[model samples]
Target: MIGFMKKDIAMIKNNLKVLGVLVAFYLIMGLFGEIDMSFILPFMSIAIMISTFSYDELNNWNSYAATFPNGRKNSVKARYLTTVLIILIMTVITIILSLFISYTLNKSIDLEMTFLNMLAMIFGTALVQSFMYPIIFKFGVEKGRIMILVVIFGTVIVGGLFSSVVDLSKILNFLGVFENHWPLVLIVSSIAILYISYLISLRFQLKKEF
Candidate 1:
């Protein structure tokens, strides 16, 4: 398991400059723009996760990995693990920045709302990955790239429809039920989504021919 994780980390290390640029851009946006940093973290994390697939496909890494014991399973697991790690790291960074912004700008940051948004993004990212990885595992990266755009636009359209159709008061009331427990709910739901995604990816990978 550790080796699999290290393999993913090694892949990411090669893209450190890209990651740095992304973080820098987001930091600038968070500091200057009206947008919340939490909103962007999940999208950034997903993009990074997808790029790993691109790297793997480019280098024929998955085909090479198939020769190792339990390689396919571990590769899928590594991708999921790497994504979770990235989300956790981003959450920490978001918290620190929220604090810094509050202190420097003399504005009060709503820590609870920030946390809730972070949790929502984490769950949203997991849900997106859940739908994405299985397709990539079965279809390879080239087709998977097209699916990525489909997933993104599909999500946006669905979200727009949901907002337009749903009652704002009812939604707020539903959220009110969670009140203090929203974080726990988000954590549990996100973990469940990720586990299901892992199982789906594993099934696809086991049947996939490199």
Candidate 2:
């Protein structure tokens, strides 16, 4: 399993030059007023996972991996685990940066609330990936890529529209009912979503063929 993960990481690192360019550009724009840094984190997380899955799908790396001792299940597990690990690390780093920026700028950002919102965004993105990655694994990247884009873009558009019409800011007031318990609720809900997504991905991977 470690070997499988190493190979995937190696593939990601080998493309570091390209990845670095993207990350740097994102950081610059985020640091500037080009876009809210908070908005970039989940998108970047989703991008990394998609890139990993897309790379495997396009290269048929799993087919080669299956010839090893651990079999296809390990290959799938390695990919899922690696993707989750990367997302968590990236999310943490993004949170720290965003907080630092908010503090320096003296913006009225609530660190805890922002953190929860970021987690919610990541969870939402993962939910989409959980459903798509298996299908991508089963089919080839060429076809799967189209569907993934549609779902992601469609979701974003709908979400933007919904937010425009309905003020989600009311969540803070609604959540005020819990008062001191809000943190616990946020943490528990985030954990539940993470676990559910992982289970879905695992089940999907188990059913997938090389």
Candidate 3:
């Protein structure tokens, strides 16, 4: 298991060079003006995860993965674990870089909102990944890419409709159950979604021959 995990970790890290280029680009933006560094991290993290999926598909990694002792389901789990690890490492790096830049430039920074923003980012990214993973597992990345775009567009359309008809702030008030503990709420919700996605991925992988 350790050997498999190390291989997966190495593969994940190798796949991150594109993300390194993106991070450098964002750092250049930071130098020019104020950019929402928090927002950039989640976007870059998602891009990295998607690129990993792309690489796995292109190389028929799962086919090779099935030859392992634990079979494809464990391999799927390892991939998901690697995705979470990469996102977390990138998030930490982004936060540290953002703080350094903010302080060096004497920019006004709202540290209080950092945890709240991270909560939202983690939940949002997990939601996107939950929707993407099942499609990728079943359809392969080429078709899954199209499904991913559809999901994004559909989400935007749904969000627009909600915005038009619902006062989001008011709705937040209506959902007063989590008023004071929104971070915990988001954390719990993200865990539940992740659990569901994991189950779905397992099912899809089980159905797959290789």
Candidate 4:
């Protein structure tokens, strides 16, 4: 698992230039845009992490990895671990950038709210990846890429409709009820979702023929 994680880290490092460009673009937008878009940072970070599947597929890495003992399960575990690490790193960066932006704009910083929002964004992104990885494992990357886009756009449309149809005040009130325990709730829910995703990916990998 450690070796697999190192491979993922190296893959991410190789793509640093592309990720740097994305970060710069989003930072500029957050600095000048009316609304805070720092959440997009973690969102894009997950997208980048998922793209490793495409890279591995293109290089036939999965077939090669199959020769190693327990490679498929380790690969899935590594991807999940990589996603968690990226989320943590990007969340911290988002917080710092949000604080800097607020300070520059002479706005009040709501650290608790900002942190909660970041966690929500990370959770949302991870949920998407959880659904995505199983498909990629089952179908290979080319078809999986199309499915990923479908999943992403479907999520956006569903989220937009849900938000529009839901009562905002009720949602706020529900959140208010759990205000003191929100952090614990978020952490537990995120972990549970990621573990379920890992299990799904592992099952897919086990059944896949490399």
Top lDDT model: 4
lDDT assessment of candidate 2 = 0.68
Better of 3 and 4 by lDDT: 4
Native-to-model Cα distance after best TM-score fit, residue 165 in candidate 1, in Å = 11
- Quick one: ranking by lDDT, best first? 4, 1, 3, 2
RMSD, candidate 3, Å: 2.7
For 21-104, candidate 2 gives per-residue lDDT tens digits of 655665676567647656565556566666777777678777787788865777777867776776676677677777666676
Per TM-score, the best of the predicted structures is 3
Name model 4 segments beyond 4 Å from true: 148-179
lDDT of 3 by residue, 104-210 (tens): 77787777577788778888888878778888898888998888798889989999998999889988777897778888998899778877998999899988986
For candidate 3, the 10 contiguous residues with the lowest summed lDDT are 1-10
Q: Clashes in candidate 4: how many? A: 0
Q: Rate the local accuracy (lDDT) of all candidates.
A: 0.81, 0.68, 0.78, 0.83
Instruction: Give the per-residue lDDT digits (tens) of candidate 4, residues 86-188.
Output: 8888888888888877888788988878888987887788777777778788888789889878878998999899989998889888779877887788788
lDDT of 1 at 181: 88
